[model samples]
Target chain A: MSDFTRDEIHRLALLARLEFTDEQADAFAQQLTQILHYVETLNGLDTTGVEPTSHALALHSVMRDDEPRPSLSNAEALANAPEQEAGCFRVPPIIQEL
Target chain B: MTDAPAYATLKELQRSLEAGECSSRELTQALLDRIEALDGKLGAFLRVTPDEALQQADAADAARRQGRRSPLLGIPLGLKDILCTRGVATTCASRILRDFIPPYDATAVARLRQAGAVFLGKLNMDEFAMGSSCEFSAWQPTRNPWDPTRIPGGSSGGSAAAVAAGFCPATLGTDTGGSIRQPAALCGVVGLKPTYGRVSRYGLIAFASSLDQIGPFARTVEDCALLLNAIAAQDPLDSTSAPVATSDYTECLGREIRGLRVGLPREYFIDGMEPAVEAAVRRAVADLAAQGAEIVEISLPHTEYAVAVYYICATAEASSNLARYDGAHYGYRAAGTRNIIEMYSRSRTEGFGEEVKRRIMLGTYVLSAGFYDAYYSKALKVRTLITRDFAEAFRQVDVIATPTTPGVAFRIGEKLDDPLQMYLSDIFTISANLAGIPGLSLPCGFTAEGLPIGLQLLAPAFEEARLLQVAHAYEQSHDWWRRRPELA
Candidate 1:
């Protein structure tokens, strides 16, 4: 991969749902490039036939009874909601009105 | 009880409470008072709920009077802020979730509560457990008790500091990438990270699901074992929690370590590592060899690639986990946004710290359509090699010994400027997390500058008992843990 350019960082900030200042974007371009450059040290090894390990443990699917159980109460679930209204999380309109 | 400063190992305190020399209420109040006086200088606690702690303490005392007993009964302990406590604010030291409270307890906290542990309240960490130092904490940076100008090694810096400062006998700290051990090493306490899935992560605000494990920081190895006994168990709530049977962790204490093979990896002794830290770890290895254990020089050939793998995996996981914090559902929300997308962007940019944004963006970049194969996928292949290296070494060794950190704790602002340097500093401790094995850090020695050096011990999966046993043996022969900062 090439060095991280500021425009690429800007695009990434949007993809990640974050907005960075011009200074932060530029700084990130440099810092992220450095971090990725160091991360490139892994390229020295030949892992041609090696399987990629996503999890170290050999985890199997867990099963449970299909019995009904009490989950969190509605009020409890909404307790930390930053914008709750009418027993639901209220949010700004996704579609702007003309 | 003797008229001493509030520094009693959990076992000693348990014996005192059992003997009826002092009531739980009195002991809890004394520790609260000590925290009141001392914790101002060391910001180990994010919140100190004396009233709630007293109520719990009274209940424990009543249970004791009624003939109830457990090892953790009436013992005051701190929780790392990352663990959710019912009605107690559980921020993972992030500004985004500063006002967040859980409606239920984390399984680990619940187990400890059932074992009659009193909550001394939450400890601080790096914002979302991201940074190497607690300086990334949204609230306050936890200062080292040994030298106030230096940082307490983090992201469980507060948990380590609280135990080392005698604010509490022990505290639970989560280690995804040496959060527990590095700080425990710097703060001069014993810290343990059990094998992945050994403890339930149901209510731990997840940083990385596959890597995070809740463990302990304590003044003694025995206290850590007692704590592990109370909390280490499978849970129906956390699917990732292994159904493997747990044993009495304390059973292995005081057991002879004769003929045990301990591996010393040459890669851990790098060129730029602090000489004192290396010396301390070598001295510990020599001490173990003197006690009839065979010391072998082993090769974990892929050791150099640990930090690279960890950053790729951990950041990728973190970016996904943190996606739930958009303005609509919970956590901080931005005001005056024209539409939802802008709201999400504004809320996240404002709510997150620089390190967090860097990681999220970096993670996004790696997982993006063009870069996955080059970065994330490549890192996973290297991860296999790292795990294989440990698996190969453990075949001939019972435990592996290494320095917990490359150096002693740095001055608070020293490495904060360079993100890459901060990430590289975790080189010694990140491998254990990557390999899903057990690792522990105990005070081995001190430097001329009076900073504590940590000696880390690694064991194969589910071999926490071995690490505790070996650490206990080393701890018994030395007085390193006996020394504390002159807090008075």
Candidate 2:
């Protein structure tokens, strides 16, 4: 794999929904490259036609019986909101307007 | 009542309570006082619930007076901060979650509450269980009870240190990548990581869903088993919780290890490991063999690739799991953001620690369009090989024994600058989480510096009974764990 460029680091920071100053991005670019190189050690063994094990247990999609249960109340659900309106989470407006 | 009950095992405390030697209020108060006096020096607890604990203790006493005899009634225990407690602050040692409190308890916490367990408080951990050392906690680092200057290991360092300091008999900790076992080793206690689906994960703040399993850190293997017994159940809320045959884990104790096959993985004792620590584990395995257990050499050749595969897989999952913290719903949010996009990114940038952001960046890169196949998908296929290696190893042996960590506890800030070196600390213990098996760590011996060394044992899934049996046999022969840390 080619070395990760500063542009690629900037792209990754955006993709991960994080912001970094110039210095922070530089440090992360170097560190992430080192870590990626380390993890790339997995390529040594050829896994030809091997099935990827997603979950350790052979778990079939488990469905419980269709039953009504006590779910969290609306107030409880919105209890920890950083911004809250009338029984709902308040968020910044889209389309460049509030 | 005497203050000595503060350090008694869960079993001993249960017996004392049943024998009417002391009231639950007395026991809880004594431990609360002890925590008040000592926790400031140790930095083990993030929050202590003296009033709530006393109320629970009083209720337990009332139930006992009316003849209810649950094993965990009035037993005080601490939880790793990642597990949500109803109405109690559940910070995963990150500023992002510094003020988040759940409206309901985690399945494990709920079960413990039903078992009449008293909640002393939540313990500290690495932020979102991301790092191997407790120094990654947004709060202060938890000191080693054995030597206050040294680390107690992480991200369940506080859980292990609290148990070691005799603040509580046992505490709950999560092991996604050796978080529980590594700290248990460093803190001179017993820690168990059950099979991935053995315990319900309804309210564990996810770090890596596929790898994390809630387990116990205790002063003894039996206490670990007791805690497991209370929490291990198939929950409807957690789809991944397996509907497997359940054993009363406490009942599995005291079984003979005679004729049990133990496998020693050669790759585990590699050169970078401390020779004295490895020798301590060797002596532990020999004692198991001396008790009529057969020792066999085994090769899990995919062991070398575990740390690499784990960092990829775990980070990739963490990147997705942590996306919910975008400043809208809960937790910390960057203020004065003119737009939603800025709100999302800036909130995370200011909220998370250095290691968390790095993992997120790496995860995003690997899962990006040009790199997904080369990194994340390849890791899954390699993960299959790593799992199969254990399947093959288990075919010949009942359990695998190794050092929990390559070395004993190091001083704080030792590996903070070198992230690669810090990640290598969980080298031996991560593969078990990768393969989704049960792993246990017990205090095997102490180093020349008197820091405790851990002996780790792994068993196949749903064989927690066998795991506890072997661990109990080995623990019975050694007095290494009986020595407590002198905090005064």
Provide TM-scores for the models. Answer: 0.99, 0.98
Please give the CA lDDT of all the candidate structures: 0.91, 0.91
Under CAPRI classification, how is model 1 graded? high
Cα distance off (Å), candidate 2, residue B36: 0.7
Candidates' chain A TM-scores: 0.92, 0.89
iRMSD (Å) of candidate 2?
0.9
**Candidate 2 backbone collisions, by pair:** none
Show the colliding residue pairs in model 1: none
Give the distance in Å from residue B43's predicted Cα in candidate 2 to where it truly belongs.
Answer: 0.4
Instruction: Score candidate 2 by TM-score against the native.
Output: 0.98
TM-score of 1: 0.99
What is candidate 2's lDDT per residue for B50-161, written digit by digit as tens? 9899999999999999999899999989999999999999989999998998998999999999999999999999899988879999988999999988999999999999
Q: Pick the candidate with the highest DockQ.
A: 1
